[model samples]
Target: VPPGEFIPVAERFGIASRLDRWIIRTALSRHGAALRSGALTLGFNLSAQTLSDPQLWDFVDNVIEETGAPHSGIGFEITETAAVTNFDAAEQFVRKARERRCRVSLDDFGAGMSSFEYLRRFPVDTIKIDGSFIEHITQSRFDREIVLAITSIARSLGCDVVGEKIEQQDTLAMLSDMGVAFGQGFLLHRPEPLERIV
Candidate 1:
């Protein structure tokens, strides 16, 4: 199932942090070799519930020490919605993660009304433009304008912009023109099993 369907339930049940821990441990253990060798840099999506957990970092440290994954190869992604929901905890988590040299990305950025305000507070390494906006960017002048504004502001903040859900050549061309350094979608490659990816 897509995480969107289940993550909220997990959060409401207060099991999201445990689930996040398991995901981090499993990904690191399974991909430890590639991560330690600097051949792969994996980003894990963190839930708001997980971010607020005080022991989250301790759990992360133990797992990373166990797996021997370099801090540089470990990354975390917090959704704009989640970040806005718990701003204080999110800010704290980002700061601590950054101190450990782990990259943090604000995913689905611009999907929230207070994105700019939160962006000013969260020291994210990247801002992933929401897929909703990218879906019809080529056909919507409004979408284009939003993307341009987000890209420009992200540039000023020295944060990378990653376009998501790109499905057509036109979308890729447009993103490239706008200087989006990275993007992820079916146009690039479809999702596959971790075994295949590794």
Candidate 2:
């Protein structure tokens, strides 16, 4: 199925929890060897609904125990909007994940409303500046300002900032100058089949 179709279908069928389980299970099953060997680390995106589900954490704990892979090898990315929508649950999820030594990142950090407030509350290790703010950042004064502000806030909060959709050298250079810790986009690397790496 196309990636876009999976969420709606899962929600409509009331199988979102099952879908989350399947995703985690699949990741562990597919990458168990590499993860155990310290050859690869895996990251997964958790939807707002999943973040609100404590059962998901239980499932993750079980997987960690079964695989014997270091919890630090797994990271979870939660979008700003999603985390803010259910702040309490997201906070709990973040704290619990951290307790297990898993890294948590706030994705699309500056795209949503009250991002700074969320940043203050969410104990994430990284914040990914929204791609909308990163695209054409060098040319658009507003975007550059937003990215700089987000980067500043992230830095103050002791979180690494990442610039997304950085498709130009000028933009990358601009982000580097702004103290962005990392960047992602076509200019750096394109998404490819995971099997290629495995």
Candidate 3:
């Protein structure tokens, strides 16, 4: 990951999706092997370009079938900008995923096009509030207002809201007060190799 040079290398080989599949397969396999242990879910970030394909749904179904992973065990994270830009195409993907009980998150939510219109059109199970807003909540009334508003709105829609990049104790307390259902950040656990997940 030096200089982040390998990111494009992954995309160039069309291996992003392949890598995602591997992670899903491995996570699910591990979870099953440790049935006596608790359940585990895997999160995968898909490139916006990948959503352009109508067959993406079928490919996901195949992966679930091959890995014996429940649709609920998989989480697909989509950027708000990409989703709003290609709402039509993304809608179909989201709907099909939901129909199959898969979880969908509006990644980096509240960062771009905070349009109520987009929220109405998007079918998602979770909203990952942008860390920028979370980080500044103690210092900015505007940030607190936005966080409060988003939490209220998302909860009313039956969607869970997660505060990201919550590094401070007060931030976690405030987010809990605002009724955020989940959190993810270094304050919690940094992403590690998949082998150690289970």
Instruction: Provide the TM-score for each candidate, comma-separated.
Output: 0.95, 0.90, 0.85
Cα lDDT tens digits, model 3, 1-198, are 641386457657866556555655666666644432326666776665566667677777776676567777778888776566567888888888889888898888888865466578877888889998999888899999999999999988989999999998889988898898799888888777756865
Best of the candidates, TM-score? 1
- Order by lDDT, highest first: 1, 2, 3
Error of 1 at 10 (Å): 1.8
What local distance difference test score does each model get?
0.90, 0.83, 0.76
What is the full ranking by TM-score, best candidate first?
Answer: 1, 2, 3
How does candidate 2 score on lDDT?
A: 0.83
lDDT of 2 by residue, 14-109 (tens): 776678778888888778878888889888887777888878877898887887777888999998766776889988998898898898998887
Per candidate, the number of residue pairs that clash is 0, 0, 0
Give the alpha carbon lDDT tens digit for every residue of 74-170 in model 1. 9999987677667898999999999999999988888878888778888889999999999999889999999999999999999999999999999
Indicate the residue-level lDDT of 60 in model 3.
70
RMSD of 2: 1.9
Q: Is 1 or 3 the stronger prediction by TM-score? A: 1
Stretches of candidate 1 above 4 Å error? Answer: none
TM-score of decoy 3: 0.85
